[model samples]
Target: MGFRNLQTFLFFLLLMLLGLSAPLSAAEGKRLALVVGNSAYTATTPLANAAADARAFAAFLKENGFEVDSLINVDRAGFARGLSTFSKKIGPADTALFYFAGHGMQLKGENFLLGLDAELLSEFDVDAEAIALNSITGIMERKASLSLLFVDACRNNPIADRLNASVEGVTRGAALKWGWRR
Candidate 1:
């Protein structure tokens, strides 16, 4: 199986490492999860198991006492609405988790998560059509005791390949680098 199939187990592993495996009773604090899976891309090949992965993981989290908002094959607008809804539910002392499984790319030093309908005529189009990672992280950065982000979009991306090919040497090198790895 691909990483898509292992995502749920990896999340539980993450929780274990974070010392959160001991089930938290609902009375302790809130557990909120925003789960997104984008399997339909306008410009690239669709992922075979993304939607299934998100659904399975959401169910697992809900069973473990999380208030889950699960979204599958959403476009930019739908993604925004989902995040907004999840953000509104984050109260103080809540543990907020965000998970994304799909095509993700870095353009001009910024990270973007692709939507179901994301189209790229050129790399510059990323900011307009794709969801920024910061937009999601900014939501989790507020009023929550612990914030977790799990992204299963690390495969070689067609957009990144094109972007790298179209740029000059130094700029290409810089743009292709996701700073987080180094």
Candidate 2:
């Protein structure tokens, strides 16, 4: 499918997963969203569409009554700060949503979302340089009544390939073992 089509599908799928047939109303409790896009990467080739897509998506969410926190071309520390602030806003009755558009890779079954300043020289750097996907989900699962995560980061990752190549017992295909599934 086309990129726009895929995004629409994912948005509808997310709403369906949350048992929502239409845009949420004010009576449904608070709606919070953290939207991030990292395009200006220093270590890897920059993405052309990520930041723009995030801005558009954030606007859409705002129109639908979501209080949005949007960040673009952010570094690791910036990402952490955004998440920390977002987590603070979430409440037990809130519906929390996270959307990320950038580079992402799976290493040893764990998914890591890359920031603009991420430099993955080895697998060891993942924890320090990248944001763990589960960390975002864990926050939402803990503080929100309903949580939705939409990751629009799928591209050829030369950094991951290099890391896999450098590590012993790590195969080229090992990164593909995990996928988004319910």
Candidate 3:
């Protein structure tokens, strides 16, 4: 390929890598959202409320005439893909929102949202499955006059454990035991 061809290729490649997509609006503005629910846990209890919360919020967004995209029961890979897809769907002057429900924890001076099946025997294993909140937020901050974020993953232990002994199988996770539910 000639130098000019190479330059053009690189330019388009850069845009694709950056998750840039068609602008949401050429006239009337539109809204987009990334709704995530991480409720899979291996070590501790799984959050039963995450699924419900995600569904409810997505419904609300749709009712408000926003294009609500979602990835429920997402692990790390799913989360990353969701973010990428969402970024491409939003643009400057457009509105976007993100809603999360599941388990969230603070580790190594960073915040991590745990998947329902997250098994964090130690902190070192966190980043693999849990992504930084900023990774999701920074996308919305790119020219969105109105960016909204609803984080419901703050429910107690920030980490869910399968149903607790205290609940006698009535409830299926320690996360809800700690009043961590919608």
Best by lDDT: 2
For every model shown, the clashing-pair count is: 0, 0, 14
Cα lDDT, model 3, residue 60: 60
Give TM per candidate: 0.80, 0.84, 0.67
For residues 59-119, write the lDDT of model 1, one tens digit per residue.
8788776789999999888998998888988987788889988888766666788887777
TM-score of 1: 0.80
Q: What are the lDDT figures for the candidates, one per model?
A: 0.75, 0.81, 0.62
- Candidate 3's error at 104, in angstroms? 0.6
| Per-residue error (Å), model 2, residue 173 | 8.9
Q: Report model 3's TM-score to 2 decimal places.
A: 0.67
| Pairs in clash, predicted candidate 1 | none
Question: What root-mean-square deviation over C-alphas does model 2 reach?
Answer: 3.5
TM-score top scorer: 2
Which stretch of 10 consecutive residues in model 3 shows the poorest summed lDDT? 173-182
Query: Candidate 2, after superposition: displacement of residue 30 in Å?
Result: 0.7
- How many angstroms is residue 163 displaced in model 3 relative to the true structure, after the best TM-score fit? 20
lDDT of 3 by residue, 5-51 (tens): 74466346534532345544455456777888766655556776677
**Model 1 residue 12 lDDT?**
68
Which ranking of candidates, highest lDDT first?
Answer: 2, 1, 3
